[model samples]
Target: MKALSYLILIPTDPIYVPTEEQAETGADALEALMPAAEEVTYDMFDDVRFIDGGQAFEAITCPLCGKDAQAWWHNAMDKAAEAEFEELECTATCCGGQTSLNALIYQPAAAFTRFTLVATNAGVGGLNETDLTAIGVPLGCKLRVVTQSI
Candidate 1:
């Protein structure tokens, strides 16, 4: 099934992974940090995932129609693996508008301590050094951030 999520991932798990309780604690910290955001969830690194989600569309919007890109995603799926785009520039099939994959808007697809924290309507921005440090204090380590769309 298709899901719309923005994933925040770790570059590597620590030598000793946190317990679910630890994960929950970390998630709660994040919740406090991003109170406007949706609940945070976790996913342990069971499968290898991209550190940087290259070519992924943060959102699919046609410049012309100003509508969801899914509206014109007629043949895009078939070309996915073949195109292997780190970024794309094309014309929409629906309104024939220009299309370009750009910055992530929302929908988290993360593996947060094996939990989830999605803010579909809230805004997410880069975590500064201070913020990262705060988040790490509870988890006892720094978390590398990667943005991925699903």
Candidate 2:
């Protein structure tokens, strides 16, 4: 089977949001930190497969309030909930300050092949966690680690 991989880049800090506005102007500082993937094309004869290696943040701080916000690594299949994935708590000395930060790498199972196929299809739009789960990816949910560095 031909294995496919996607490198999704997300901010270690929740303060940043990826959007079209950032994609334009060609000068968004956040663009430097966004994730990138190599180009690949699958032909009709190719077998579809997926390899998990995406990263997610543990904690992000508010630039103004400096309050810490926890991070999560959710499986596409897992339902969204208040306490579904991992959570990082504030540890900074400052009152209400947040310090913990984490990044997670998710690997999809064999079932993820369906999602990959959709993502690769020319008629299909794109694939998000929800789309991945809708197809049949396993639920290996939750943040697995916590650390200062991303």
Candidate 3:
């Protein structure tokens, strides 16, 4: 099967949701840059939700111990899903330290967000710092991109 790619942008702050206007502005900026994208979309969720990279996903690391936490990550994800991801707190198996699942470093990048702007099949590798700043201007917040392929 051919892999499909999505470039997803989210607020740096996990729980932040951009206003409709802000979201529109960000989407416009993204579309302008990714003119060849198959589609662009804005999604707002009532509750925080996970945006994973599917087959592109890589290992997750413990924030406290900096060890591979892939073993613990799935169980934590299942537990968090039980509440629709309203709660992300978990104890790291590596160090037994308290942390939010959102704090774990995903290799290919993932996040918990209430809002997102996505460009499908964008083809570009990733946004540069200048491009990120350009898009962030209208959104009025720092942003991060997660590249998902499946």
User: Which is superior by lDDT, 2 or 3?
Assistant: 3
lDDT per residue (tens digit) for residues 1-150 in model 3: 777889998887778888899889999999999999999999988899888777555689988989999988889999999998889999998899999998899987888999888999989879998999899889887888888877
Sort by lDDT, top down from the best:
3, 1, 2
Per-candidate local distance difference test: 0.49, 0.27, 0.88
User: What is the TM-score (0 to 1) of candidate 2?
Assistant: 0.25
For 25-97, candidate 2 gives per-residue lDDT tens digits of: 1112212222242332211212222223334434444433455423322322232223322333323333444
Q: Could you say which candidate leads in lDDT?
A: 3
Summed over model 3, clashes come to: 0
How high is the lDDT of residue 112 in model 3? 91
- Candidate 3 ranges with C-alpha deviation above 4 Å: 1-3
lDDT: the better of candidates 1 and 2: 1
Give the range of the ten consecutive residues with the poorest summed lDDT in model 2: 141-150
* Steric clashes per prediction: 22, 4, 0
TM-score of each: 0.47, 0.25, 0.88
